[model samples]
Target: MKRCLDEAVLQAYLDGELSGDAALETQAHLAACSQCAAALNAAEGEGAFLAAAFAPDDSVNVPTVQLRARIDAAVARLDAQPETNARPSGGWNFGALLASFTSLLTFTPQRAAGFAGMLSCVVLAALFFSIQKPSPAPNSPAQEEHMAFVTQPPAQPKDGSANVEVKDAPTAPTPEINRSGVPIQVAKFNRPHASKPRVKAAPVASSLAAPVASKAQPLPGEKDYEQAIASLSTAISHGGDAVLKPQVRAQYERNLAVLDKAIEETRLVARRNPKDKDAVDFLMSAYQSKIELLTTVADQAQVAALGR
Candidate 1:
């Protein structure tokens, strides 16, 4: 600007809010002054960025008809609510409020009806209080009798009904207590041949247990486990005896011995109890262990070859 452009005016111009002679003058100044032009360009860039950044994500949503009308109506209703916060410009105006209230009290049918309704409410409340009976005082005989009735057991009826037990009110039943302090059921005393409290039998353990876990059953392929172990062992030994490190070779031999022993023991178990799931599982595991040992040695041999 010939005169440095005010930031606010420059902002307004960038927003396309400035018009007429002012806009024309701003355009001319921007063209002549590189500094103002740079500022205007920066402002434009910032405005564009802000607009894009805060823009509503409308791509995924279906456009609603009359969106502006709905928004405007909501804003109008918000503005129309009566404000309770009176302006503090004149401070408190008690006298003015009192005068207004007095004016409202002038004789009118509406006021008369309101007064009648209020008087009716007062009368009803007074009548309710007046009709309520007072409870007996603590020391009174009636109060004592009420307390005794609750705390003391009912007196047995005289006459022929003396043999019959009676209760003034049917109180909640209390369970019968045995000598051990356990609550036993209170069976009907009137029932014939009622002697002992029936005891519930303990639950028995079921024979079923998930048919043994899937892994606990024999592995698939009748001879596959045997073939796999043999093949893996042949692969490991084919690399030659001295190829393995001393410690590694010892460990491998030891593992093989253990696997062999496990296999023999499992075979014996399986032969004795072919139908036993545990024995079958043990036999399968022994074969798998041998296979794993062979695979480990084969991998080590390959690693050694790569190192060479």
Candidate 2:
């Protein structure tokens, strides 16, 4: 008896479908060949996994009569096809048709349920994003009016300074009066007292002034958030008990949360590119957050114990 096993024979042995001499020969080959034995073992393991993963539920079993009826219907459909082809059709080649049908089978009720679940998840995600996203507020007439007012230039102040202009007020009308039966006209302009020569009021200095300090501008690429996070983490790790204040603890906790989120984002990037520096930077930040948390907690506990 030949001790060598062909692929089909090996498969049959794995399935326990072989019988008589062939089965005995396959068994002998499996016993003698470590490679064949390992292959068989692997095949059994895979089959067991599939069986457990895809086993039909007892609650959803098909009736024997229904199964038979389906088999009969399929047979009838096959018989109805013409035995000979009159000419080649452009619809689809046999292999392509089979592939398409196989693909369609992949979308069976179970698979279709899975696809529906996935679609529902996507829709829910989109809805959540839409709800969470910030949107532009609708323009209102009041808001428009307010905007117009805001956009208008400020009224110029009255002063004799370079940036200011002073305007004189209109003089009041003088009234005519009769005194001692004689009519007299009163002048509105008063002549300056000869004794005090008018020192033209030194042009009133401007009370309203422009800000002397200009706004500060950020430097180009000077501050990196990733490097900042990493530095924060290093500080937490090294500082240990030095950062024990409540305010410092709160700030550290907040930064830790940010670092955690950043690290998660970096991990997603790392999935695409293992060598991404951003991912590495985020990882370092995450490490720092952990260390900081531990150190802060330890310090806080020590402080509490000392008070007791």
Candidate 3:
């Protein structure tokens, strides 16, 4: 009897879906595994809470007046249409109307303007058609010349004593350019020599190296400053007693000024030593305080909007 239980088996047991030996085995596994036991307990508790919350109520029955109205409207529409056993009609017939409108437009005082527009349109259409046309079958004269040069067999050493005989290959015909002016070429290659081995390119280095982990250091006495700023911002934004009460507003301003001085000192330290983490931490704290100040000002605007 295997004592180990998978997540599904454990869930089924919790759900009371397993039977006999399988159920017993799951129960035994749960007893041994603390994590599984805790999960099963949570599931059972959730099930009990749901059962209590959604126990059926027979007293509530909402009417469907809106649903009934929609159904009636749809039925009425279907009843009004004539019966059709033939194939459905295709697209709308507007060819004659379009031709008449085009003819009228061509004869007006706007004819020159129309002709310029038409010519521009024709040029644009030709340009787009040329771009989309399958690139004219590589028939450029330069490409053909390069291919011929590469395919021409290497000149053999002139020796009557050599066993192998070399023959000159036939030249390819030049490609003719179309009036639209597009070039095309055919690529050619000579028989590869067995004596010379082809060298393949080396594999490139990987770009996805493990990133250096950066640990953010907590600035000393900065948390208190942030909390003060956050509190003042929240109070001003919400239009609470802080704005209406002079004493509270004065205290908020004083705390902000003190934090500003501390920030300046931190900035000076940072300027002296650029890589100091503490100085960087203090600068970030200052930025957080400035954000809070802006947030407070925006909130005051919202309060004014409410008055209007």
lDDT for each candidate structure: 0.69, 0.61, 0.63
Cα deviation of 244, candidate 3, in Å: 3.9
Q: lDDT: which is higher, 2 or 3?
A: 3
In model 3, the clashing pairs are 138-184, 138-185, 139-184, 139-185, 140-184
User: What lDDT is obtained when candidate 3 is compared to the true structure?
Assistant: 0.63
- Residue 10: error of model 1 in Å? 99
- Which has the greatest TM-score? 1
- lDDT by residue (209-244, candidate 3, tens digit) is 111011223345546666766766665556543333
Best by lDDT: 1
User: Which of the predicted structures, 1 or 3, would earn the higher TM-score when compared with the native?
Assistant: 1
Better of 1 and 2 by lDDT: 1
What's the ranking of the predictions by lDDT, best on top?
A: 1, 3, 2
Clash count, candidate 2: 0
- TM per candidate comes to 0.27, 0.21, 0.21
Candidate 3: where is the Cα deviation over 4 Å? 1-243
